[model samples]
Target: MPHRSELYEDIPSVCWPIVYSPDYNITFMGLEKLHPFDAGKWGKVINFLKEEKLIGDDLIVQAREATDEDLLVVHTRRYLNKLKAGKLAVDRGWAINVGGGFHHCSSDKGGGFCAYADITLAIKFLFERVPGVSKATIIDLDAHQGNGHERDFMDDQKVYIMDVYNRYIYPGDGFAKRAIKRKVELEWGTEDTEYLQKVHTHVEGALNELKPDIIVYNAGTDILDGDPLGGLAISPQGIVKRDEVVFKAARSRRIPILMVTSGGYQKRTARIIADSILNLHNLGLIDKELVASEAENSKVEKMIRDSVTDLTNLSL
Candidate 1:
């Protein structure tokens, strides 16, 4: 039997697949300010969405922290037992986990502020619990290499990874790079035009190479210009367009996708993330109304099929 999890519970039809929680924000007496990454940016992203009337609390799916069992699905037992710390809100079509993108952590190790490998866990949970989800694709567009998941799935052919990051950044792991089937290395200050072109070409190329059961998009805003860590120079509009390209590719192929907000360092990054989400909505990529309409259509089709079956039985 497949594993049952609260994280994969059925949500109300009215709610969007965007996942978030108050606990996602880390606060330890202003100590988070010491780090370059904005720890509170997750909450700020939610606030921006609310202020723009894009989403209300009730209309969004609340994120659940990953339990030990859930973590063990992809992580080692020793890793789960050692720290005991964790934490997706998407249905079959598409979902985005606003808080998770711990691509720097692995089963037995943690780094770059990532304690647990949530990306790996999410994919594993789907494969174990959700039927017909045996293959997965990881599209890591963060400023730094996603060494965590790359290491974990290094030997697993069921998972295909395509990583595009600044080559000069942190965790220059040669072993991890071996896992990336399609690797696009960027130089410092790579701007929107060149950056977006590569993202578009490579994303399409990767999908064409292999159509996976789902696409896991590690959408990091750290590639924004002036980011101290990311080292690239993608513009705000470029980020939004980049998301559109990936989501469009998945939607076109009718593949289920889950996006995670990964590594964004600046305070304005929150607003940009929110804006990108809104752009996706405007493009009809993540609209709640569209999902509801599809559900109603499915219900109607089932009812009609039942009616036809009843008439046939009566004739017999």
Candidate 2:
């Protein structure tokens, strides 16, 4: 049997695949404010969703902190220990981790305020533990390149990476650029039309190239206009539309996708994320009834399998 993990526990039928936890927010005596990134934005995103009646605490999947064993699935032991000396992981079926799009951190190092490679770990875990999940596609729309996972999965053919980022941003790792199969490098101050067009084109192109067992969408809100670091001019509506496009593509293909909210430094970024999620729900991309029906089907399948197993055992 595959190693059991709290992160992969079967969620209740009523719960949505959106994963989050209060601990995802970082607040060290207000020291987090020193950084340009809004450290508390994770909590704010959840709050806004709650206020909008899109999701409730009870209906959301609680994210468990990735343990050393879990992190080691994709990270080096030395790197895992480095995180242990410092600090410390997703679901299947169109799940979303409201926190943890740590795209700048890799197996051997950490950067860009990211301490662990959660995106890498999530994909590795799914491939290892989930049956028939042999391939993954990473759709990274973060304003900065997702150099971290790019480096980790450099030679791994099973993982296909598609990154869209401002070319001039921090950690401009030329070596990491080699890892991106579909690289869409945007110039500084790129606007909504051009950015969205590129995203739609490449996303469809990547899926058409190879339909993976799952998709790891690093849905960073930092692309919004006036983001201090993202260096792009995408509007809030653009962000919503972008998400809709990705979700529609994944749902239409019946591909299980997992999303992680990445780097968004602005105060309003949280609101934009919330609104985008609401738009997804409203559009039936993440329908509650659909999930409930899937859960019922799963239960029925399990019961039939159990009955067959019992009959076989009795005959033996």
Q: Best TM-score goes to which candidate? A: 1
Candidate 2, residue 225: how far the Cα is off, in Å: 0.9
**Weakest lDDT window of 10 consecutive positions for candidate 2:** 307-316
Cα lDDT tens digits for candidate 2, 1-316: 5555444445565776676777777778889889898878878989998898878989886655555665666668877665552212234355666777888888888889887777776666656655566788999999999999999999999999999999999879999989999999899999989988998999999999999867889899999999999899999999999999999888887676677788888999999988988998989888656654554667642332122111100000
lDDT (CA) for every model shown?
A: 0.78, 0.76
- Top candidate by lDDT: 1
| Residue 38 C-alpha lDDT in model 1 | 88
Candidate 1's TM-score reads: 0.90
**Per-prediction TM-score:** 0.90, 0.89
